[model samples]
Target: MSIKSFAAKIFAGYIRKKIDNWASRPVEVQEKVFRKLIKKGRSTKFGKDHDFLNISNHKEFAEKVPVRDYEELRFYVDKMVAGEPDILWPGKPLYYAKTSGTTSGAKYIPLTRDSMPTHIEAARNAILCYIAETGNSRFVDGKMIFLQGSPEMEEKNGVKLGRLSGIVAHYVPAYLQRNRLPSWETNCIEDWESKVDAIVEETRNENMTVISGIPSWVQMYFENLKARTGKPVGELFPNFNLFIYGGVNYEPYRAKFENLIGRKVDSIELFPASEGFFAFQDKQNEKGMLLQLNSGIFYEFIKADEFFEEKPKRLTIGEVETGVNYVLIISSTAGLWAYNIGDTVQFTSLSPYRVIVSGRIKHFISAFGEHVIAKEVEEAMQEATSSTGARITEFSVAPQITPEGDELPYHEWFIEFEKEPENMDVFRDVLDKTLQEQNSYYFDLIEGKILQKLKISTMPANGFQDYMRSIGKLGGQNKLPRLSNDRKIAEQLEKIKKQ
Candidate 1:
């Protein structure tokens, strides 16, 4: 056996044993984790300010630390950025991961010595778990092409700063580094188009076994490779069998990715963020990812429906029920306390807890009294593609304001296509029909004459990327939103088209 495959076998075996032991008592494990986090951080500035010493249990802990978003925590984070050591954690963070999509454009989330290794371990376990379940390790024997940001990080207060993926890329297990490619210099190129070309040129004939990246960027790479070689990706890398992806929902680009690869391959999904690595797809039979209970994070859930209320009820790991939409609150070793990262999720299992992402708190559309989320948009988009045999490259939706003289507001979807459908009217109809079926408020609005059928506008192939680049959010961990309550994103797209 090849050395790489031999190493994978050992890694996979160890992960299986750990998974079996951890999966047995999910609640108990989480309680222990919370305790460890509290004890370890009780003396930090944030802990002292929040009265962490007085908190002995989850209830007191919850009462002491109210839920907060980045804005609320900005005071402490700003202090850290100015090099105030031990403001949040025990010492200064090793680096910061620059994230986007806030009112403030970009946010620098700390990457601490205590927290960075957790990110690495979660990724390692995600791969090993897949191998343990599928008995497929051949992919590990060859190189993996990770489409990540440039590792040419900037420094803020003596701490390195870059995209989270680039920082993690710098610290993956030494053994796996031997099987990974496209040199660091090429990855450091700031121009995405040039970087993609460099990646395509370097790895075209290599023994590629796995591909890991955001779906859209991967699509761009595949498009470039196909144009250069006049062949599908499967022909270029016959041994490739695994695709690991995250940072965006894969549903809209599912058919396009398959068409590019020329076959179905094993896929493992992860819910990773600058804040913490929360979940991963561990079982093929399961509907959602297993929530990592012992990952140095203390989790709280507030029902999404009540998230904006005067006082929403908070649920802990033991009290959480399946099928409830909850806004996840995390307090982790990264020095964040009861921080809301904006993503909402629904639990699918409780015994061995697992969850599926529902949508972003800020990205949902509720302008017309019809609450539509990323999950609904994605499912509707899938049905539309399947019924019409069309393929979408990227899409975003916004509520079209009702005219001053009219009571009906409709949805306008801006889409870029890989393969356009023969019948545009049918494609639009199926998409509207699926949304009506998925969301009751949306269905009521359409049926009661409160809303009109959704409209679809075709965008130029590169329109979305153009807008993203304009906003300095192209590539790396950046992702497009599925739905917006306002026309902010739609208006930007229109301007890009005009340009």
Candidate 2:
């Protein structure tokens, strides 16, 4: 190993020990984090407005500070954007992560000086944890590529504004700076297609090892690389072994990715957002990511099923249980208080608090009182593909309430296939049966003649990509929702579906 790799191994071992120390006492660490956040929050305008002075514990905190989404929190956020100090966090924010909001047009999530380091540390420790566990530090000596947004930033009221990934690009550690690709100019390209082409030209022949990005965008890069060089990505970059990703589940895309790379590679899943870096896969054999209990963020969980109910009970980390889906709420050093990020997660391990992102709270179908989530659909698809030896490129699920004929209302699955299943009927049956088995309400609806078996609508090649492009969200942290309650995305898919 090179000197740098040797040093990394030693550092990784130290970091792993530190992680274990905190992870061992998850509840205690979280309590300490909660205290610190509450203490700091008392100084902010929001804190005072919510009567933070008398709040002594999680219960009081929840009672005083109602969970608010971005739109609900915009009053304070707007003040922060207008250069007001102490509106949310102390002083002005260091940066504003600009993201396209669902209801609100544009959201500027603050990145305070105190909270910024946690993001950097969590990302670094994710790799360090991998190195320590697998004893694979040599990849650190090879080139690493993060398919992400431009590093360029715009200033609004003296605060730097850009995508979260772009802001993070500025903080790439000095040690890995030498090994990171593509060139700054290539990353700065506004168009994703042009950027991917430039990236391919810049790093096609280089010794790349660690590649990280959303799976869909990386799939596009892999396809472009194959098109140019007539070789699988693995053959082109022999050293590449680790694939790190977040934003969406990778299971549905796993078969397609394996086919593109021509081999199976280990991957790390991260749960990161503009609000906070919540978790990361710590072990190769583990089912879920290790929740960051001590990351200067206080976490609360409300059972997803009861999330819509009035005055739903909120549970702290110590109160959460395994296998139960809960909507994740966070109050962080970044000044977000009792903020709902809209993500639902299920705990796989309660001892160290490991969780998998289950789905979005809003992204589910309940058109017929048969609520179905993204995780269920993705799991069903995974099982069907595994059984049929089919490879899916992309897919989305929506409730089809009104059929053209006498057919009963059913779930419509829009699928883009990398390799179509030999038996379409069998594939559809497996999907429907699997979904019914997982969701009891859906099972009742189907059995009671209220809904028919789910139907599959195959899309033409690049159909999903075309839909994303048409909506002006083709790349850079944008993700196609896996499940939708309405037909907005489904209708768009229909327009581009193969005849």
Number of colliding residue pairs in each model: 0, 0
Model 1, 34-128: lDDT tens digits are 88888877878898898888888888987888899998999999999999988889889999998874678678899898888889988889888
Q: Which stretches in model 2 have alpha-carbon errors above 4 Å? A: none
The residue pairs found clashing in candidate 1 are none
TM-scores for every candidate against the unseen true structure: 0.97, 0.99
Which one wins on TM-score?
2
The number of the candidate with the highest lDDT is 2
lDDT, candidate 2, 375-494, per-residue tens: 899999999999999999999999999899898999999999999999999999999999999999999999999999999999999999999999999995899999999999998899
Q: State each model's CA lDDT, in order.
A: 0.87, 0.93
